[model samples]
Target: MTPNALLLAHDKPAALRPDQLRQFQELGYLVLPGFLDRDLVARMRHEVDRWVDDGLRARSIDSVKDPEKFGVPPVMELELPAHGELITWSPLLEILDQLVGAPYAFHHLHSDRQAPDIPGKPWHHDYEHSTQTDRSATMIHALHYLDGLSTDTSSLVVLPGSHRERVDKTARAHLGTEPLPGEVVLEELPPGSTVVLHSALFHARRPRPGVLGKPRYFVDASYCEVGPLWPPVKPYWRYMLRRARELNLAPDRSELFTELTFAEYSRPA
Candidate 1:
């Protein structure tokens, strides 16, 4: 498919088209420009400011890094009303249902307000398989660019079809954020754009040096197809899942926050 084919316009139908599904299956990523409504974006941005400004983001990270010391976070990203809405947004869930093509479980959610001068991230993937054996099941990351991409902010560079390779997440880290032959640079998306990626697809953040840029409001949430027991990333993952269920984030989606979908939490070596 052509580069343009990878992106679906905001005004398009909420349901995933057969060709769009095929593109995701083949290319391992799909860009949804302006996928979110303006009102929702405004609310999420407000919550992001509160999340960062109030030190909630830091506390959440601390809990993950040193769970015994910090214990459970005072608040989770999903606890924020707007964030909860975004995570279980019906239209988005419907698309996920089509893409995963089976029952799936919520994996994790991260929210951030990145500085303009933040350094570029080396190429890496975030797929989680306890044994790292195969890619038989589907796992996806929904990268929500709340304020969207522009020349001021860093671009998202993704290597098409890389998920098919069964290598470590950092297999291409040595290459840093340098351009590669087949890499696609996404830098000009409108506000509230979202890019859904196959969790194993290699990607990087390419920052533009020497330019004054605005803060990039980003929120990413992942979900996995539910046949195998997936590894939980955070130490307090059980509590997080429990809180999500208590909040009824997705009342109609029964498997979304069930504890049976995950194995015990384990820190990375």
Candidate 2:
């Protein structure tokens, strides 16, 4: 399919349209072209470089890998001014508010500048439920491509309507990132584009072959509808929420930083 046709995944309406809403409900994803402002995207790119070059990214990973030892990183992605702004970006929240159909809590935020040679990630979903039961409640991830995508950068491949199937996050891991039937390859987005996905949607990152890839400035932040208590991915999730509140990232979004949205953090067995 043509890039423009593929982008029609979501209607380009100033406000979320009913048709767009229905698309998300049925397809489990929406692509918002140029969703973020260019200036904000530039700043986010700078922050991503710092996050990687200053060892902050390493520290953040250590906290997740061994929270008992690293506790929390000295900095979280949302603490960065532009990154924080992106989290509370009105347009994004508005679209999400419509899709979620209820108050939603901030799940987590991650920023990265993927190396040119980054390998393809196996197909996987990122939904965070304790039992992995139903898909009634929505958990959406706002995937921001700061510099946008092209043949030079890795593409995001997603299995359409896969979120409706109740299966383990890694059920498709063995399939790798190869093109699958009914899968959409997002390779031609403009700068500052954001592709929102139902967290349960199966997706993969496929790097370009032969051609030298460019550094991909990517950041993703997730939110969950307020119904059941969601599982916290970070052990320092409380601190993360507190820091977001202290920074006053989303003053009107009372549910955004609240602790009630999550159940107790359980160590992965």
Candidate 3:
């Protein structure tokens, strides 16, 4: 899609209300059922299939492991046409801008299709902090369920208000993917649903047993509020941002691709 067309997607985003903002601040997450555009979601699924099947996804991972050897990937996820469009999809960015309450930088984007029997991922958080210090700024992960959730598919389980606890991302790892008290099991949503999460919020993926459901097309892209120099997860983050700029994903927001928004890349402990 053209840059002008991408901007139009932002024109009719559901308004973010004061109460919703308060809920996010207090609850640590918000569920926008069927928030993503249908056409965009369909295109994203195509890119996702190609990303996994064409070996680009594996190549991207290999580069991250040994940057000195692999260097920048031959192709990045955002380099994919639909993936690029999704990153700057206007409505999504508007919600992000409101939640962050300041300029933010694109952190990373991950795309994958889970098999029906894929094992449940253990409880964890994606907040990137080497020191595991206080939550001074905001970082969010937009978890997109292209096919949505159902009884047969794996479900997202999250602990409400977990972001308030200043614990390491793995504080709850020992708990595994088992259900917990006060947890919310998100099992049903429409095709283009998105669950926007505080990166610090604890969440898990629980797969259904004895039910081999359809493949789950999942893509998550994250952004960090601009304040402190945020750490970059990918060794080739510079290349990633440069590609986004080359593609003009966010033509109006220079900060989205600015190098100054990030600290030097470090191998996480």
| Candidate with best lDDT | 1
Off by over 4 Å in 3: 1-12
Candidate 3, poorest ten consecutive residues by summed lDDT:
1-10
lDDT for each residue of candidate 3 in 1-269, tens digit (9 for 90 to 100): 11111112224655677877888898888887777888899999999999989999999999999888988888899999999998998888888988999999999999998888999998999888766677889999999999988877899998878988888888999988999998888888778888899999999999899996889999999999887888899998888898899999899999998899889998854
Estimate the TM-score of every prediction.
Answer: 0.96, 0.95, 0.94
RMSD of each: 1.6, 2.3, 5.1
What lDDT does model 2 reach? 0.86
lDDT of 2 at 190: 87
Better of 1 and 2 by lDDT: 1
Query: Each candidate: what lDDT?
Result: 0.90, 0.86, 0.86
Model 2 / residue 99 / CA error / Å: 0.6
The reply for model 2, stretches above 4 Å from the true place, is 1-13
- Cα lDDT of model 1 by residue, 1-106, tens digit: 2364355555666787788888888889988888887899999999999999999999999998999999999999999999999999876887898999999999
The most accurate candidate by TM-score is 1
Our model 1 lands, by Cα RMSD against the true structure, at 1.6
